[model samples]
Target: MNDALGEPQSVLVLGGSSEIALATVNALPRRRLRRIVLAARPSAARDLAVTTLTAEGISGVTAVDFDARSTESHSVFINEIFDAGDIDIVLLAFGVLGDQEAAEADPALAVEIATTNYTGAVSIGLHVARRLRMQGHGSLVVYSSVAGDRARRSNFIYGSTKAGLDAFAQGLGDALHGTGAHVLVVRPGMVRTKMSAGMPEAPMTTDANVVADIVVKSLRRGKETVYAPGPLRFVMAGLKSMPRSVFRKLPR
Candidate 1:
């Protein structure tokens, strides 16, 4: 349950090692959080996240093994977590940004991207939503992207996955309306994270902490959708309205 200030007492991060997800957790009121569950693939990165949080004096930090592609086990995995205790917030932060050129060259690679980004999200997202509805009070923060606003030739495969995920999350949010289980869709432009490293910085590129701040603020304000850096919302709107011919001419 959330505290008097409406701060979440417990957070469940599906992509525990995600820099943006971890930043959002760190930005929260640490003193009020009773539990922090980092669910991700078994790896040193997941272990490091727990160790880092523990070092920050955040108690009850635990790590659980979670593979996004393993949709068959999502039901059981989510059930086990919810059975342990109530989860105030669930961050659907797991995704893979495969090499766009490689994905275009290999149909199998494209499938991998779709599986991890779209299929896996739908698998876990529904399970999380069901649990949240049962508890009757919680928020689901989904990490969408500006690229999804309109697919670009530069990264259409990845963009298509995000576009599907964005629509699915919005519909899920609507389905959960008045159920006390809400969803916040976060669309950020190119973010400066390990995932985007080596990529050319876009016009309004920002960092993970900046996006984290927007997420926390939006959660408190009960916003349904938010664009990090604030201005990206307007920017995306303009881009979305552009003719495909003009859009294609735009820089990569």
Candidate 2:
């Protein structure tokens, strides 16, 4: 599974500390990857991520501070990466799960969710896409969710954020349709990741490893969209068709 440059040596993950993102990277051929750039906010948690990747045999690991709110600096951040060389792949995995209640109380909170989940990602990703296109190839994997299919009252704020991200990724995919660069939009059902640790688990909940495996397979196959656990595609279809009144009543 060596890439053209001797191996899939260089990789970039925007939310390098994300559990799902980390799982996906681990699932990749470690022997083929020489370096992994993990961009995340500085915190004790991110420091632990560096140690974990190092323990997993990912030797060339670098952590850079990236604030999703600072969309203006996204270009500079990406330029720094390309200044080195063509990155094998870039995963836009950064996002925040805002408290639904808080968002409802304060519109600013909702705006924050939208900015972090959608605007910030798209800003940086579009830049990366252009770089990949110019270089003639690379993979961009964006994390969307089934909740984006239809906004549910239980989690409409979060759902809406995903909806925007899903749409942005799709449009980006189309815009780069003929370019050698490609985009993969991943929709996974509820998972027990740290993001949703306190929430009750949902049906067909998958592990981070499962999501990672699907992403890898999707990239290999050049799939435009992938649903984790696979069956979620149909599940979401049925859920989306359900009456809103009924949908809202269903226990999450």
Candidate 3:
């Protein structure tokens, strides 16, 4: 359950090892958080995440086995977590930015991206939503991307997946309206993380911690949607309004 101030005292992060997710955990009121569940596939990174959070003075930090790509098991996986205790927040943060060129060349690769980013998310997202609504309170923060605002030629495959995810998250938010269960869709531009370390830095690029701050603040303000750096909201709006003919030629 949340604290007296309505700050979440418990959290469930789908991608336990995600830098941004971990950053959000750190950004929250550490003293108020009593239970922190990090769900991700078994890995050394996941283990390190648990150890790191614990060392950071966050109590009740633990990791559970969770495979986002394994959609069939999501229902059982999610229910088991909720059965143990009520969750105050669920962060749907699992995703892969597949090699665009490789994915386009190999259909198998593209399918993998779609399956993980879209199908897997939909499967787990709905189950999480059900539990949130049933419990009658909690926040679902979906880490969507600015790339989803409009598909660019360079990484349309990844962008398209985010597009689908963004739409699903928005609709889910609407359905959960007035139920005390809400959703916050986060659309971040290029962020400095292991995921984007090698990629060219985009305009208004920020870091994982910055995005984390935005997530926490948005949740507090009851914002349905937000941009990480805030300015990207206007940037995305302009690009969204621009004709595709001219938009396509712009640098990705």
Candidate 4:
């Protein structure tokens, strides 16, 4: 539940070790935060995240085992958490950026990327929405990407999954209309993170903190969709306007 100031007290992060998700949690008013649940496959990184948050003075920080690809476990996973107490905010931030060339050569690899990003999301996202609607008030932050706005030949395989997730999030938001629950879809360009390491920084590439700031602001203002760095909103608009013939010829 949220505090008197509407600041969230209990938060759930699906991609527990995600830099953007952690940064957003940091950006929130920590004074009101009481419980934090980080759901991810067990790893030293997950343990480190819990320890780091606790060391930083955040209370009730804990981690639970989760696998995004395990769709059958989603219902029980979500039910166990919501049954314990109300969740004020949920961050759906797990995704993968597959190697386009490799994925094209191996259909199985493409299937792995698609199932993790699209099918897993749909399975878990619906369960979360049901719990939120029952509780009557909460926010769900879905991390999409500018890559989803239009597919590029460079990473079209990964981009296609984000596009599917973005569409699903929009439809979910509409389904929750008139219910107190809210959904905020975030589209970020290249973010400088370990997942994106070794890639050349694209125009308007920002860090996790910048994306986190946007998430916090968008949540407060009740925006349905937002772009990280803010300016990329226009950049994407221009990209989308480009004709396919011209768009495909541009540098990767």
Per-residue C-alpha lDDT of model 1 across residues 5-95, encoded as one tens digit per residue: 8778899999999999999998887668879999998888889989988898888899999999999999999999999999999999999
Clashes in predicted model 3: 0
Writing each residue's lDDT as its tens digit, candidate 2 over 1-252 gives 236432466789999888899888888766678778899998776788789888877778889998888989988999998777778778899988889998999999999998999888879888899888888878899999988889987788989889989999999999888787889999988877989898888889999999999998888777999999899999999998998889889876
Clashing pairs in 1: none
TM-score of each: 0.98, 0.94, 0.97, 0.98
Candidate 3 deviant stretches above 4 angstroms = none
Clashes of 2: 0
Task: Give the range of the ten consecutive residues with the poorest summed lDDT in model 3.
Answer: 1-10
Q: Could you give candidate 3's per-residue lDDT for residues 25-121 as a string of tens digits?
A: 8888666787899998887878998898888777888899988788889999999999988999999998999999999999999999999899999
Q: Per-residue CA lDDT of candidate 4, range 1-252, in tens? A: 776676888999998888888888888878788899999888787789899889998889999998899999999999999999999999998888888899999999999999989999899899999999999999999999999999999999999999999999999999997799999999999999988999998999999999999999888888999999899999999999999999999999
Question: Global CA lDDT of candidate 2, please?
Answer: 0.86
Runs in model 4 with CA error above 4 Å?
Answer: none
Local error of candidate 1 at 53, Å? 0.7
**Alpha carbon lDDT of each predicted model:** 0.93, 0.86, 0.92, 0.92
Would you list the clashing residue pairs of candidate 4? Answer: none
- Which window of ten consecutive residues has the lowest lDDT sum in model 1? 25-34
lDDT sort, best first: 1, 4, 3, 2
TM-score of 1: 0.98
| Residue 4 in candidate 2, Cα distance off native in Å | 7.1
User: Residue 4, candidate 4: how far off, in angstroms?
Assistant: 4.3
